[model samples]
Target: MENLERMEGQCLCGKVTVTAGRRDAVEACHCGMCRQWGGGPYLAVHCDSDVQFVGLENITVYNSSDWAERGFCSECGTHLFYKLKGAEEYAIPAGLFQSGSDFSMTSQIFIDRKPGYYSFANITPEMTEGEVFARYTP
Candidate 1:
């Protein structure tokens, strides 16, 4: 795993906070479920298992899939993280961290499902839905 730097961020309402170790590479998920959840691709950074969340009561979790769950701030409806079940791994929204302005768009996943209405200007590496499943699924 790449060495990660400590990062911190808070929800829009300031009701919840998150601290984690993150890399500078940001990835975009263009899967249908992700688009439906955020009304667009989810731009996030993969976080280490050392993620910490404050204000537990202000957070809500949804079982988005059998192997993963999504978290958000209940008070402000701010999306927090997409976490894999039975693991400490998390994909945190890149926009949440103000310090992440230097992050670079490195790659995109589920390219096959991306809508034609929009496109990213960066010519980053991409993975198709099948490619993503094959690489990530156990």
Candidate 2:
């Protein structure tokens, strides 16, 4: 559809530029790799399917697993987005987006696998691996 929110961002060296559309939902992930890659929890925003990706070919994708892929800038090492095979959508890290955008976090995935050091004060829905597999598995 039409662009919902005009958001722009770049990698550390400004080599990778991304423009997302209609991103309003965010999710904070405390998974081990997410923490290691970002030095903290990863904040992802669910952008519209029509997002205009520029310089995306420059971004290298890592197949985190058979079902998931993580995108990052090869030069600056800026983690960008995560995509799950057959999941019908992509997840862009909220921190990678331009600041001052209007967005709110919705859900926290892999809650049971989240690191133990951090505790969430807000009452958000949590999902375990079994729950995710149960819901997504055919």
Model 2 clash tally, residue pairs? 1
Question: TM-scores across all candidates?
Answer: 0.95, 0.83
**Candidate 1 segments exceeding 4 Å error:** 1-4
Model 2 C-alpha lDDT per residue in residues 1-138, reported as the tens digit of each score: 334557887777888887776566678776777777778787887765655567876799899878888889988888878888767477788877767366666678778778677876767777776787798677
Error of model 2, residue 91, in angstroms: 0.6
Residue 23, candidate 1: C-alpha displacement in angstroms: 1.8
Question: What TM-score does structure 2 among the candidates reach?
Answer: 0.83
- Candidate 1 residue lDDT tens string, 32-66: 99999999999998887888999999999999999
Judging by TM-score against the true structure, name the best candidate. Answer: 1
Measured by C-alpha RMSD in angstroms, how accurate is candidate 1?
1.4
Model 1, residue 11: distance off in Å is 0.6
